[model samples]
Target: MPKQTNVRCPNCGIQFAAPVETVIDVSQNPNGKMLLLAGSLNAFQCPNCGSPVRVTTPFLFHDGSKELLMVYVPPELNLPKPEREKAIGDLMRELTAILPQGSFKSYMFQPREALTLQGMVDTILQADGVTPEMMQQQRDRLSVLESLLGAPEETRPSIIEQNDAKIDTQFMQTLSLLIQRMAAEGQTEVAQQLAIVQEDVLAFSSFGQTLMRDAQEQEAVMQEVAESIQALGAQPVRADFLSLAQRYAGDDQRLEALVGLIRPAFDYAFFQDLTAAIGKAPADEREKLETLRDRLLELTQAVDAQTQAVIADAAKLLQVFASAPDEQALDGLIRENVAVLDEAFLSVLLANLQQAESQGKSDLVAKLTDIYERVLGVLREQMPPVLRFVNELLGAPTPEEQQKMLDENAKAFGESLLTTIDAVSEAMSARGEDSIIERLAELRAAAEQALA
Candidate 1:
């Protein structure tokens, strides 16, 4: 029976042994020599320090020293440069003979590795008096590798050690090949692969876009703060400006100028909304309507509710801190309901006015006129901003109109077409020129048919 031994790491008192495909040389010993065998014995690896432990095996010797079973191999087990060169030459000749006749001439030689292999061969040829035999050996080795590339993936072992690294490299290689094929033949499958790769890139791009948008918003806030400080000399700074500055403190420096402008715009807008609510015209006699005037008293409460609702929804969607139910939105909802009631009240007032006029009640008519004039005066004070707000809301474009804006930009459309062309070109490099031309012709035909 053959004697067995275990391998352990000499350092850190750990054991580390595994059967790797590659073997090592270990012939530099003072006593004799040794070979680092991969799978002759059980190799142990230390869990703590990851050291290889060595063990000895009892050799069939008559009362002699025991032989070390597990050996440590050094590097450079392969042939020297001269011998290796000779071997490579022989390999190339063998490869050439195995290839189908005229394989080089008839086939356009779509070697994906052509550039790399050729560069290596060029470096070799730069040396003086290198014979064809030497070149042939290199070709043989590469030919073998090419065959492996063509083989089914499951049959070939992955050469890369790390799973993540291997996967990423394979994906990139696959994508390059796919793109080349698409360019040459415009295959639908190739296009689909390109789309998948694009989706992955876009996922990363969205993060950058979000960062940019946030930066812009913050910059706007800061600008407003700076302007206010300059104007008021920073004594008892306005409450609104202070809040705006604090909110955008973490934003980019460029935002300081924009921040100043943004707050004034918002303030002006708020007042505009207020005036519009007060000054809105009464609805038609027949059609009762919730005119802006009815919302004048509770306008601020409504806006507060709207703000809280927007914030809560955003937080919920972002999966951040839980946004509790806000009383502000509730207040706004109440104000809207009150406006509905006011419309009905106006209708009743109009009815009472008609009744008094029909009965010739002069005193009652005069009292009703006074109330009507007072209401009109209040409406006049608020009319400008209220109508402006209403106009802005109604005048805003629908989704369809926004889409049209994107579609109609001539420069953008041209740029998009250019992008598609670039994608096609990138894919074509992997595929052959003939294939690409053929595919383009097919596409042209299809387009003509569709037009017809």
Candidate 2:
């Protein structure tokens, strides 16, 4: 026996076998008000077009899980009786040349002249000016002709011809072929859709790469401008970085790169003013330089807040790290990265504690412990594993070794924060934060090492 065909497009009249998945909605109650699926059939699709298909498996009379296999008909594809009749009429017209006048006489159940009358009716119905109202009147007349055609033996000699039957069957076959052509057309559509998607992605990637390059160029410009302004003994204002920053403000990736590039300038600005003060000068000259330095310090105080404002978006800021040259834009990047990590670390710690308290589970503290361990693990992975272990151990039993790591990590965030404050302070001849100033070297070293 031949394999059975399982699926067909009612629209196109194409048929083929297919493995398909089907959701079986099962009703738990006999009232048919509530439904639950006994089980779903899986892995079913059209072999030709890959279109998803479903088969409604009927529930067995006895066993609930044992369903009866049944043929599926898509409800929307069913043609109404009137439409089917019209389709048959249209097919008959296609076979008009092959049907003899004697054949039509038998079909119409009247004199041979009736065949010509039916042809005139069909011609008027097919005309462009014939409206639905006119077609309805014509169909009423067609009903009479249909009745005559049904009585083939009575209508044989005068109203119908033998050739009519053969022509009609051939026309029905042509209609079936038309439906099959439609099904074949559906198979090629998915490829056209995929091509459109590929084109869109290529365009987006090209745009992204262009924007990234523009950001790098702007970052270089910002660095140059910052250095120039600091060298002139002037403060770089918001306007100084605006042109390049504005170019990328709307772009998340480019804006991040801009921030990383400017950070070093801020650090260098601090160093320049502090070192400038050691020059020998008369009392008034020294005082004037000190005053100018103080103003520069005030300007530096706004840098962090301003930088944060420029890179306010979290999605945009993440892109900066990727764009940073060799992962070291400046010493300050390390401090900034650490501060971000510290803030995130603290938030996670607090959340874990809250959850532990709510659940009354002391073991929940393991999450916090894991995070702390990861911080150390990241250091080990970044550096050497032995060095990481050494640093961890140094923080405990060996006080001397412990202080070194403390001082090192402390310098960038702890000391660097102080240096930034002092640079601004001394540039204006203002009071310095003494502890930070003394530890500046260690802080700078830590920042440099972290970034390196």
Candidate 3:
């Protein structure tokens, strides 16, 4: 977990709070690795100036899947050789305390240190087969993005004109991807800023403007596809959907139209169409057709995964709440996920309660509500700082009062709350309290080993 530390902005000379985590044990919660890759792991937006600043702290990156362990200390810190060795020793000790007995490999004892965070990330990406050329392209996009954001409104056009080639379809897609991630993580302000940038890109850049036009056509095609699919009788199966796909032109235009529109719905039926299209194509063009099919298949899987991950968390929490044999089990689950009392979980509980009520079950509805509140009370007791902080912020008399409180206690409330948020976000991918319990057990077992 990141700690709250003071940061004095070079430009503004005002100090603000930021999160700095030194040890990231990705074995327990791999989602932390994702946040790290997205560049949001330890990023803080200065409330005073809205400028993004990073905490200049060393971090350990661990990925058990690859049997890899590494550390990064900023060269700017310039710790003495003895002190650097001591710090690395301390960090590794902590890492050892969070893994199961004998789970760590022999190579982990000899630590690898990076002089920069980028070097650490690049190392990981290279292992994943992301080419240096791809990494350079990403860096180039970021450079142009920085320039555009820094330029004045009047000068922005010139910056855009100079980097017009860089601001192509790929850039727009990258921006859209980031925006979705921000929204999912509840970073509303950042998502809004990205949206504005997206709008400006779509309006100002020639390629962006053309892509926007194509997107409109895509949406139209999607609407028509939806209408066509719905017009089929109830319980339409794979055959029915494929029959609809056959109505489109057999050439590349049809494939493009199909992909442009109903991309997410490319299930077995769509694959059937793709198979037929591939079979009909000339041998030379068959590879291109197969490539298109492969792309859509990958896209469909991703779309389905994102949806399931978002909603499955809520559903899983509900199941745990309803199935707890007694208060102890409920307490354990709530402590594990922290969303034991969230509304989505409650909605599921309420639906079950209503089902019981409809069947004339006695006191089940009241029983469910009581159990929920009781478990929530336990969470408040266990993590009062977070619970109290969130309560007061929400219970503020007015928006202005809320803002004032946040500004005054930024350090007390902000970094601490963010730690909990990071935990919760990681938990979204968890199976339920069971997975969380197993994870915590692993940590506890490792801690005990350190004590031994």
Candidate 4:
């Protein structure tokens, strides 16, 4: 839990309450660890002048996985020796009191002191296997990004061309993370500027262009394979999948897409059937079938591995939310990690919620439910206004209710609401969602009349 402390803004002199995090436990509060690494922990913008202010106070950093305990006190604080020692002792006592019994180790008593925040960050990164060279490289990339962001809009292309070599996968990833962080902090103008820089980087840099091209090709492959599977009808049997696999035998991307899209269909029984068919195949066809079988085995293994990794990451993130000390902290974590709140994460949350309910863990079930709703709320807030309105209209229970909603919001949405309804109706129709399509059609009529 953060301590709300009165902070006087240097720029405006107006005082405000800021949540100051004095202790970061990596095992429990991973989100705090992330914010600390991002250099935004205890950072706030003044309400009066909107100037960034950072709280400089003594804090304890603990990572149980690494068996690391460290303490940092801002040098600028200039506390007397005894006062500093007492502050450190207080933080240590607070940490030890909350830790599980018998889990305290010797390192907790004699916490290592970091002379500076950078030194503390470096030590943490080093423990995570980030070498000094890697750190320098990251710093270089960050410098280049800063230069790009600082340059004039018209000059960005040339700047990117000059520093194209520094613009690699890690650089782009860092830029993306910065954008997300800025947006989460409500710095919309800065986030928008960073977004423009990202587009220019993707446009001008060599690696960025390659990434763009690969993304396009992958999207095309996904669409083609999705259409193929859709053509397989509602109930595609094992033989149907086998035939589909053989059709795209040598095309690794399409084969990968096929396997990823319908991984469950390629079970042990399906593979056994394939082996049987391969054994009975003619000599000319046997080699091709065998090759396809080998390739599919590799693809399935890769897909399963990737899925497991995603699930593990999702579970870890969910645990962070569950361990949040308060609703405010949980909401902040959700907003900070919003970019990763995808179907896989939601599925994991749902499964956990179901298990808690079944096991009669009412408290856990309630917590998970709150997290789930908050996650969905954040996601909806990110959607376009039209889509959000459509979602609200759909949530109305009956035609009368939907019609009432449409009437209330018609002036605001105008004809755009009718257009969105039509688009959604078409999409739902294609997916064979008859009930939804019917409701959308009626709503579309009502909306059109309302707008008219």
Residue 222 C-alpha lDDT in model 3:
56
**Regions more than 4 Å wrong, model 4:** 1-20, 27-30, 43-55, 64-68, 95-110, 323-325, 354-366, 384-387, 393-452
RMSD values, in order shown: 36.9, 30.2, 16.2, 4.5
Instruction: Provide the lowest-lDDT 10-residue window in model 4.
Output: 44-53
TM-score of the candidate numbered 3?
0.51
Candidate 2 vs 3: which has more TM-score: 3
Full-model lDDT, candidate 3? 0.64
lDDT at residue 55 of model 3 (Cα atoms): 65
lDDT of every model, 2 decimals: 0.35, 0.38, 0.64, 0.86
Sorting all predicted structures by TM-score, with the top scorer first, yields 4, 3, 2, 1
TM-score of each candidate? Answer: 0.15, 0.18, 0.51, 0.80
When summed lDDT is taken over every stretch of 10 residues in candidate 1, the lowest stretch is: 58-67
List, residue by residue over 1-452, the lDDT tens digit for candidate 3.
44456677655678765445678887664545766777656555445554555566667888877777888877898989998888888889888888899787977978787767788889889877898999999889878776765666677777777878888767877787677555433355766666777777777888888988888786666556656665776576666655565465344444455544455456676687779878988898788667766765655676567556756766655664566555434443343344234555656666777797888877777667766676556445434466565455545777567656656664555455555544543443232244645543443333233333
Q: Alpha-carbon error at 272 in model 4, in Å?
A: 1.7
Clash statistics: count for each candidate = 48, 22, 0, 0
* Residue pairs with backbone atoms closer than 3 Å in model 4 (clashes): none
